[model samples]
Target: MTEKDIILTSEGREELEKELSNLINVIRPQVIEELVEARAQGDLSENADYDAARNRQAEVEARIKEIETMLSKAKIIEDSNNLNKEIKVGTTVTFQNLKTKKEMTVKIVGVIEADPFESKISNESPLAKAMLGKSTNDTCEVRELKEPYKILIKDIK
Candidate 1:
């Protein structure tokens, strides 16, 4: 794996840790049991159950490794230095659409934790990119979008 930092929210890190624990504790044991049961069924040649069990095992192991690596280099987004309420990772901001005058609030998060349905947008997103480092009442245009748009930062926390 590349030696670069993996940005993550605290909640994201906790979720990953929970997933790793589940894989190691519960899924790993179940896969081992499946392998044992499949092996007891006789010939290794053309054993569908055994093949499926092996595949599942491989997937589980790969995910565990991935999560481990991510957690190892994870950099949790910190809001401690954000006394001015500047838009940045881990900060929630309310912005108004310049054209429509529609208002919405969203929390900026890392790519791994971004969930639009939950109002958590990635820092690399066009809107977040345009708003980052800007303060309340700041107006910025997101030109990277297909239909470029502007937003007025109403509030940041």
Candidate 2:
């Protein structure tokens, strides 16, 4: 069996590395201290702090393993932002809805780094799917649950 490769931008890889460092250096020590403190409290049978500390330890260790696995299989995508070039992961795209006439800018990123609140959209997203491989001034149609909408790419950087 083989693990699927995780596509990530350079920025995404950096973020994951930073998080892993924090987990291992800071949070892991804190969890150990919490467990030690909880164990020091008398009866293990009725100790809520012990149970909570154990749970937190388990969660933190699991996350550490997950991050390590992702990093092991990660493929970093380097962005080449040639003007009007094809859009892809790590590209910031600006497009206008033909119907609503609203212009929006979004950064295309990997699944792990996608944050709609930050205008970073996942490459798997319908809008990003339609826009990838297309260049500026190209029109693409995005299908959603409600209805399909057409967008004209205004810029790619």
TM-score of each: 0.93, 0.94
* Residue-wise C-alpha lDDT for candidate 2, range 47-136, written one tens digit per residue: 999999999999999999999999899889987656658898899999999999999999999888899999999999999999999999
Candidate 1 C-alpha lDDT tens digits along 76-127: 9866667877777899899999999999999999888899999999988988
What are the lDDT scores of the predictions, listed in order? 0.91, 0.93
| Per-prediction tally of clashes | 0, 0
Candidate 1 residue pairs in backbone clash: none
Ten-residue stretch with the least lDDT total in model 1: 78-87
Stretches of candidate 2 exceeding 4 Å from the true structure: none
